[model samples]
Target: MTIDLEILHALSEAFGPPGDESQVRDLLRGRLAPLTDEVWTDVVGNLFALKRAKGESRGRVLVTAHMDEAALMVMQVGGDGLLSVRAAGKTEARGLLGQVVHLGPSRTPGVIGVQPVHLTPHERRQDLPDLGDLTVDIGVDSKDEAAGVVKRGDYAVPAAAFGRLGPLVKGKALDNRAGLVVALALLEGDYPCDLYIAFTAQEGVGARGARVAAYAVEPDLALVVDGVGVDELPDEDEPPPDVRLGEGPVLVLSDTRTLLDRGLSLRLQALAEAHGIPYQVLATRGETSDARGVQAAGAGIPTALVGLPIRYPHLPVSLAHPDDLEAAFRLLQAALSQPG
Candidate 1:
């Protein structure tokens, strides 16, 4: 199947930060409508696309990719029009300083503010700025002016642009958006069982959407697509040693929060080897995806995880190899086509 680079680029740059996923939902709905038999959405804003198999019945298979990204929420507007924000999810405070962010609906632009280096005394130069002290400046003069354009509860996300750096794509939300792209690409092809593709919400927080989507779909088997960190920086001290970019998709043996399905893990590995898709094994001490929530839902659905290797995860700029995304797409497509 041919990859739609335009859709992929748009998806990577779409604005959706946790509880506010409407923008991305709209784009996904438009793209999946033609490929799916029935498309619907859950109350919590999870997008579900269903495709039935021909003739008799086979159990359903659920494929999920989270639609939310790490973000900040406006807590209060200071008297001087500086907006104080509360960090949402696992956001990096260090990466936030001096970064441009986008506010809700109106898409108002703001820049994270930091103390000028020239004004900092020598002794305080080594200190990292605290989240409480940081504010977002949108060029308003007072609280009333800022309030007219943005509200107290509005969400904020990094102002990211999608572009390719050689063979790799760099953007903000690729963590799971890349996975969403893979799910859409797979849907463009045929598979054996009935499929339920759920673009879930609030994954960075607690995997809330995955739980609800799993209960609603009730699949015999579930596969989660997401991004994992790769050690690419030179000065990094013995990087996570789990996954790396350009090594295809990483199959999780275990993560800090969940142990993978042993049988499913082995089968995925065998499938990758047989198909000649580049793959790597990743065991991490502190990472979890929507797969954890899916496995614990209801009577305990059998689950597996397919992760794209990412650089600088949870930051404003995250990186991934396009070939790794294609590998993940190939792997999941093969898995879904096989009999259980």
Candidate 2:
């Protein structure tokens, strides 16, 4: 199946920071309602779409894609109209300086500001600035004015556009949006097992929504569709990245918090190879995803992770290869079609 550009554009451009995923959830729910038998959400904001098996169910199968992205939260509004912020998840202070952001539910425009490098002390100039050294300037002149636009505890996301760059797709939050597109596509096919699609929330924070959704669904097998990062620099050295754009979808072996089901991972790899779909493997021990929570829930679920490699992940805008995106969809479709 080809990628749905309209859905990809909508999901990529929607603002859905950790713990605040209504925008993304709404998009998925509307698309999934017509394709699934049931669509519902939990109190913590996780969206679930279920499509029953065609006949006797082989088993309950679950596939998930998180709805949240790295973001910033306003900690305080300074008297000068600047907003002090803390990272909500994977937001990096180094990438935020001077970056444009949309704040709160209103999507008020703002730009992150930092002290001029030319005026900073020489010794401190080389030091990396932390979140404390940054402030979001909302083009206001007083705290009251800023308060009228934004306030303490409001969330902000990168103000970025979604578009294709040659063979690459560039946009904010491609990390999980790419996965969402695949998960949405899977709903189009009728599988042999009860299929559950979870558009999880708060994944960037700590996979909070995934934990609850896993326990609720209690699928015999779980697969996490998400984004993995690439380390393909022009001059990059040893410990080279195992994942890369255009290469294929990633079959994650292990990450910081989760060790994927080896049998499930191997089955996916075999399917990809047998079907002529390109695929890759990643074993980074420092990275994590919703599988972290899903694998440990309810006596244990056999969980596997399929990832689309992203460039400049967790930044304002990231890049992904459209081919990799399609490969992921094709592979997961094959996996779901197999009789367990």
Candidate 3:
């Protein structure tokens, strides 16, 4: 299968954060409208595209991916041109010391500020700054000046561009953007069932968008695609992540809070085995996925999570392999080529 790297690059670099997905939503709407018979955005900002079957419809299949990424939101502007910020998703303040963010719709450039290490007492140098203590510097000299360029509730995301880095694609928001691109690729194939492609919102803070979409669609089967990064990686001091990058798409059996439908999960594995698609079993114990909301809606629906492992997850520089991306697209295409 020939995967389109250009789509990945565009999506990875798009400006999107939790509770604010208009930028990414516009991009998806334009790209998906021509491919499907119907495309529209719902009340919660979830974008849905539907393509009907050629003949008699067997069943409806809903494939979903979240478009929102973790980011920083402006809370207050200080008198000294300092913009106070907070995490928009699960992103931490530790590795964000020297990061850059583009503020609001204007995309004004700014940097997260910190005290220079040279001035710190030698005994207290190892201490990390709290997220609440960090501020964004937008090159202004006073609070009113800074307010003219930025206001409270303005969203800021890392000013990272998606590009090739040796063997992997690197940029911000690879976690779920990678999955969204893969889902879009599946539209190229024909299927016996009617297909619904949902680009959901607010998945970083919680599965808020997926919850409403699942209930609204009410399909017989649902598949959630995620590009969640590994919690920990293999190293001299730490054990390997439960799932590894470049291996294949992950067939999520269960997450920290939800037990996915066994029948569907096993069916995906069977299809992968039959098609010679390299796959992995992700039994993560610390992170919750969109499955929680999808599986618990109304009378309960069968669901499975098709995941791709990202290197840094929520940071501005998440990395993913092209091989794994193709595997995900092919697996979804072949699995639903005929309805189960």
Identify the candidate with maximal TM-score: 2
- Tens digits of per-residue lDDT, candidate 3, 1-340, equal 5678888888888889888899888877878866898888889899999888768888998898999988999999999988999999877887688899899989999999877889989988888888888899999999989877999999999888888888888998888889888988877777888998889998888888888888988989899999756665547777767777899999887877789899998889999999999999977646777777778877888999999988888877888999998998888988778668
lDDT of each: 0.87, 0.90, 0.86
- Looking at model 2, residue 110 earns an lDDT score of 96
Scanning candidate 1 in windows of ten residues, the lowest lDDT window is 234-243
- TM-score per candidate, chains pooled: 0.96, 0.97, 0.96
Clashing pairs in 1: none
Candidate 1 per-residue C-alpha lDDT over 112-192 given as tens digits, one digit per residue, 9 for 90 to 100: 988898999999988887777789999999998998999999989999898888888888888878888888897887767
Which residue pairs clash within candidate 3? 175-227
Candidate 2 yields a Cα-based lDDT of 0.90
Reference-based lDDT, residue 309, model 2:
90
* Cα RMSD for predicted model 1: 1.5
- lDDT (Cα, tens digit) per residue for candidate 2, span 273-323: 999999998766477899998999889999999998999899999999988
Candidate ordering by TM-score (highest first): 2, 3, 1
* Number of the top-ranking candidate, with lDDT as the measure: 2
